[model samples]
Target: MQLPWMSRTDRRHWKSARTTAALGELMAQWLEGSISSRPGYTPRYGPEDETRPLVPTLAALCRAGYVTTCSQPGLVGWGADDAWWEQRAAVEGVVTDPVLLHRLVDAATTAGLLVRTIDYSRNAPGEAPIPVTTRNCETAGEFGGRISEADMAAQWRGLNPDLHDEVSHGTYVIILAPEYGPTGNRLWRILAGSVQEVGHAA
Candidate 1:
């Protein structure tokens, strides 16, 4: 589908597409337990500064409605591809983050633009949980270091005193950026529900 906000004639579009496609390929490699750096892409700073290839591509996808922003830093969601096409018909814009793509997906879903399923699973014993919606499942468990259930509860309490009225059993809380929109909020809710269901099934 043709996105209105995206410049079809811009050279940046081609560059961003290449970057996004390269990131996709690299993500595939990571998922397969392989770690090979992209050729000719050397870090100007720390080893952790490898987000260059991901950023612009994410912007393109977000502009194109392929993903959405999430509460977590460097995290995003996959939106309905069909809805993306429909939205593309409305206006022209630029998506600077993949998280916006997810937001578009959420908007599309709420607008009855598409139907989607949330699939979630726990990793094997001694392993981390797997978020099926992400392209890089290996990074799912790295969000936060291990914390005792009691500590988790204490942290949650510290952050949300109002939640004290709610039961804390089996609850896991993580902080996210405050700028999230309605679509991102809904996606988080869905993800939480999926986690609860998976835990119950196990």
Candidate 2:
């Protein structure tokens, strides 16, 4: 039986789960020294003080099913169990590797887990769309001038259909832009959201 608050379609529940997971992961890292407390230390996200107690966050994580209290002294720290590790692993699995990350993104997009925008365009008068630059643009415009105007316009259209009417192009180019997390903590949140969504759906 599904709890009224546990519906898969409930955005609030999803957000809560994600936030809990992120907090758990962050606390775990802090305890493990993956993040440090030195004056010059900057966490993966930014400079932040670490002296604050994590008990409240741990309580939240416990309520969200991403953590549990352990009596073992060695395991008393923030991320001391399988639940937290599994959630962190899922997020790391998707984000650390480029290929896997793309696959995960594709899955999320297909599942409607997130909103994706694609931009596409054709090559100029003489060439096939510059596959290299086109693909680069899909990620970011690092190789600036290498991308043709048509390809850029096509890619913009593919990413945003509203732009299709604005660009009358030669070939189809597409870049998928997804609004997901880039930070480890944020990534964990996304993974937690995915897990909660799946569990609730089941």
Candidate 3:
């Protein structure tokens, strides 16, 4: 189903809380299947999946002729793959704080310390190419850190979230930036150390 994002014009029916909620719910379900599957998706279920977890909803959606994957293909500068259903996700949403979304997702799903990057390296008709943002980093030299350390901490307590958290779990975690080089790395590192430190302090 095509998401009627927060567009200024047009009374898009997808704006309803029900649609978004249902979609997010479906995404959660798909993630459950993806964890034991592949990095780019849950479409091709594996032995680790919950036995055709998304088949029902997906089949119904397909029968109804809803645009499932964004196969519209991204612009050249975007550097995204453009093969139908090649690089697809069950669903995607816009957010101001992608890191927070990632953490919240980790807390919401029992996928067992899961993690996934949101570069959306697919044929994104809408949410393509990802964005870049200035993150506040805490350096020993002082005058660092854009987002608060506390806010950046991982919700899942662990000795090392980056280690315990398996990226193979599924499609979760969305970094506003296109690459993990700095922002994504910082989030993972920060959350990992913060969680470890708190665990030790306790």
TM-scores for all predictions: 0.19, 0.19, 0.21
Per model, state how many residue pairs clash.
12, 15, 4
| Best by the TM-score measure | 3
lDDT of 3 by residue, 53-135 (tens): 33443323322222122111111121133321111112222222333444434532433222333332232232323322212
In model 2, what is the error at residue 149, expressed in angstroms?
24
Arranged by lDDT with the best first, the candidates are 1, 2, 3
Residue runs of model 2 more than 4 Å from their true location after superposition: 1-34, 37-96, 115-202
Q: Over the full model, what C-alpha lDDT does candidate 2 score relative to the true structure?
A: 0.28
lDDT of 1 by residue, 1-94 (tens): 2222323442122223333333333333322324222212221221232233334433343223222222122334443542211000011111
Please, what's the RMSD in Å of model 1? 19.8
Predicted model with the maximum lDDT: 1
Query: What Cα-based lDDT does every candidate model obtain?
Result: 0.29, 0.28, 0.27
Per-residue CA lDDT of model 2 for 90-150, tens digit only, reads: 1101022233235445555654432222222333343222111112124211111234555
User: Which is the better candidate, 1 or 3, if ranked by TM-score?
Assistant: 3
